[model samples]
Target: MDYNLMREFADSWGLVAMALFFVGAIAFALRPGSRKMADEAAQIPLEDGRS
Candidate 1:
């Protein structure tokens, strides 16, 4: 494949693919029952040796 063809495909479809992935990631993060897990992760640094 030539550079022009590859560049064009990346310029168009690559942008679309990246945008869709971004939206899907945002949706996953905002879904129900995720807040508790996020909060627990946030406290890891402050927690002691206790597991």
Candidate 2:
């Protein structure tokens, strides 16, 4: 619970955890067949109140 212990953990395992999360997110964003969903998501703001 001390500052040094927390800082050491953050400097080591925290960096690894963040790096893994970043790579996973990049992989998800670039996966196959995601373009259609991404395009649809991109248009959500332009759509009016109509369905």
Judged by TM-score, which candidate is best? 2
TM-scores for every candidate against the unseen true structure: 0.88, 0.91
Q: How well does candidate 2 score on lDDT at residue 8?
A: 100
lDDT of 1 by residue, 1-51 (tens): 999999999999999999999999999999999999999999988889875
In model 2, what is the error at residue 8, expressed in angstroms? 0.3
Q: What is the TM-score (0 to 1) of candidate 2? A: 0.91
Compared with the true structure, what per-residue lDDT tens digits does model 2 show for residues 1-51?
999999999999999999999999999999998999999999989989775
Over 4 Å off, model 1: none
TM-score attained by model 1: 0.88
lDDT of 2 at 36: 92
